[model samples]
Target chain A: MCELMAMSANVPTDICFSFSGLMQRGGNTGPHKDGWGITFYEGKGCRSFKDPLPSAHSPIAQLVTDYPIKSETVICHIRQANSGNVSLVNTHPFIRPMWGKNWTYAHNGQLADFQSRLATKYHLPIGETDSEHAFCWILDQLLQRFDGDEPNSEDLFHYVIGLCKQINELGVFNLLLTDGDFLLVYCTNNLHWLTRRAPFGKASLIDAEMVVNFDQETTENDIVTVVATQPLTDDETWHKMQKGEGLLFCKGQLIYQSS
Target chain B: MCELMAMSANVPTDICFSFSGLMQRGGNTGPHKDGWGITFYEGKGCRSFKDPLPSAHSPIAQLVTDYPIKSETVICHIRQANSGNVSLVNTHPFIRPMWGKNWTYAHNGQLADFQSRLATKYHLPIGETDSEHAFCWILDQLLQRFDGDEPNSEDLFHYVIGLCKQINELGVFNLLLTDGDFLLVYCTNNLHWLTRRAPFGKASLIDAEMVVNFDQETTENDIVTVVATQPLTDDETWHKMQKGEGLLFCKGQLIYQSS
Candidate 1:
């Protein structure tokens, strides 16, 4: 399996420290290599980058460590070949537009016979991975249910959950999604999270030779949350998730849940 | 609730079309104007941008729209205040490092009476949101369990999942995490994904006034996956998750699962 990383902060914070460590795993510390990608949100805008090279040896990855771009929400991935070939087209983290919003998605699991069941009138896959094919299938179902119209939140949530159940039956379906308003995350295997509040302190990186003094970089009112496939530091404690749990994140905190 | 947007491709692919549509929801079509964030990963490097301003009116957002940065994995979030005050520090995505890799996180739910529960050895928070507190708490636990060492994959996975369950008891704990190798997602409420592969076609945005012709932008071997809080298009279907399900994504496809 590959790895995943995410962040939610109370202020515009840079991910240089954490990202540097993750880069090492692409081919150095761990064995993800295949490819890597990241996305940053700035105000109403977004800045993203991707490369087909192993993050551990990629020049692009170095730039990220040197830059200090800040954001409130972010998602990233490094690939380890599974169903698809080790090519640039088979990277993680995908994006689309739904209900007048740009919905982003990333997956880490296999769906048995996904292509056979996928059907969409408005969306189709551009790659060969079952992960992407599954995305198209879900979009097809949404269109069928809503009839090209935006449904209310309650209805939309129910519909998406129902669809998730069906897809899960085909295979694993852990996922993360957003449309610029709410963050929806679901786990079917392994995931972790860490939230910080007032009284920030010093923290060191577990992957690379780096460290950060939150006391110096943040204020007393800042609140930030970091999520990852594995704990990113040797000195930090990480929270894991149970199988078949879904929750939503809004405004730097969790708000809703279903299980 | 907030909104999230992500894309995982076989090769580096631009999220311009989907992002354009998602931008509308930051303040134009939705009320997630509290803040916005986006992270793009290229190889081992990442480029991210975020603002505490509404994405719809931010000049930075406009610039993002004009620039076509591409990546294999991307994560973005738009904010809507619920627990913490609307400040730049209270944005969606947060970052940290561990096990020689970078980790990014974003949440979409509110935890009741959530606060940092670290054992005083992990990094603390600078804000008051439960999200940040949770981040620190998780880090603290990981550090404690591993004895200041990065555990192996299986050990890390088991330990982290245990932590997630602990936090879930506090309230909702939906999350997205990445270390640039894989995308690990957990759902305790709402999360969805759609995968795309060969035989692609045009996809219209449900929130914005734009569309993308996948056939023109991708190859037959390309594989991509998208995760979202809600489907971003009006005519596409999105797969939803069960209350307790988690998945891992690697190489633009699913790899691990728990339900």
Candidate 2:
């Protein structure tokens, strides 16, 4: 399995710190070095960068480490590549458009059965991987349901969740997605969350040599939450998810929950 | 003050169903008629359309209703301008590129005490709104901290959250951001989330004349999450966030917690 990290906060925030720490794990501390990708939302749009190289050594990851792009929502992934070739298309954190909005996604698990069946529907795969094919198939199914018109987010979410359940029955399906307004997450393998508000404290990452004293940088009213496949930091308490748990986050808080 | 809809799902899904219902609220069911914007994340990029008109009347929004582009993540906003003049730059969702990645953001609240004290160390305002200024400042701080290099996601997230907490103390700050990798959300006013997993059901919007039966389009393993400032559907249960809450979502679930 790969690794995933996401954060929603009560104020504008950046994922650089945690990303840097996580990058170390992409290859240095972990084996998810096949590829990596990340997406950040500014307002109603998104910026994404991906590399087939391990996040630990990629120049792009380094740049992300130094440049802190602050936003209310963020998604990132490091891949082990069980079902996809190591190419740009095989990278995690895929992007697409639906309902006139930009949508971004990343996944951290394998879907062995997603190959042949996925190709039967949706657009062709731009890369040789089940991930992209699955993504395309999902979109294709969505288009089919809506008759080529964008469905509402509510409808789309339910449909997609249902699809995810079906996929999970075949294999692991941990995923992260966003539409520049909300963050949707599902975990069939590994995931965790840690929210910080008043009384923030210092945190240290387990995989990297870094420490952040949130109390020094935050106020009593600030609330920040982080989600990841594995805890990025050792000092912070991360909440583990049940195998089939998922959640939707907006404005730094959990709005929808499911198990 | 405005109606917003977003979805993150484990599968690619179109948002026509929710948009149809939300469109009625754009002018018929809600007051956020100043403008509307939506973005979808496809593979490794994004597609977005914006109109400086009410979603109910905008041709672009109508086109969105008619065209289905499926994506894993989606963000849509119907605006009621509180800051910045009514222009494209003043739209609810703003997009930018940082550290070689696309960033998307949207806001729903007003900043009261930010006009005068905006002369800070980093990013400056590209638009007249405090939101833009804050975005610029956050970028500046990130650049400064990393000396123009992209920091890791964890570091960036922590740094941005620090700045967000500081500025939010000065005024209202309810915002969304993404880099196509993670969804980071901060709330100072209002936000909600709804997530569905296996055994999905039918749902209808509370503010519009639309309904969707997810059973027809969904699989059994899908995990989908939706977040919004207000509930878009009337028939489905929506989760509300308490004041001063923030979170980070990845992989279709909440990974971080903040209160």
Query: Whose lDDT is greatest here?
Result: 2
- lDDT tens readout by residue for model 1, A1-259: 6788877776888888889888899999999988887877654334456666899987667767776777777778888878777655466676544543445667777788777776544455655688767776777687777864767655666677677777788877777665544556677787787777767776778888788788888888877777777888777777786677776665567766677
lDDT of 1 by residue, B1-259 (tens): 7887777777887777778888889999998898887877666445566677899987657756776787777878888878787765567676544443446677777787575333333344544567766776776677667754667555665566667667777777777766566776777887888888889887888887787888888899988888887788766677887776777776578876777
DockQ of each: 0.05, 0.03
Docking class of 1: incorrect
Give stretches of model 2 more than 4 Å off: A119-123, A147-156, B1-259
My TM-score estimates for the predictions, one after another, are 0.51, 0.51
Best by DockQ: 1
Each candidate's lDDT (Cα)? 0.72, 0.73
Lowest summed-lDDT stretch of 10 residues in model 2 chain A?
A119-128
TM-score for candidate 2: 0.51
lDDT per residue (tens digit) for residues A1-259 in model 2: 7888988776778887899889997789888898888877767555566667899988667867886677778888898878856756577777655554557777777677677656533344455666666676776677678864666656666777887787787678887888777788888979899888888889998887889999888778877888998888888788888887878777777777777
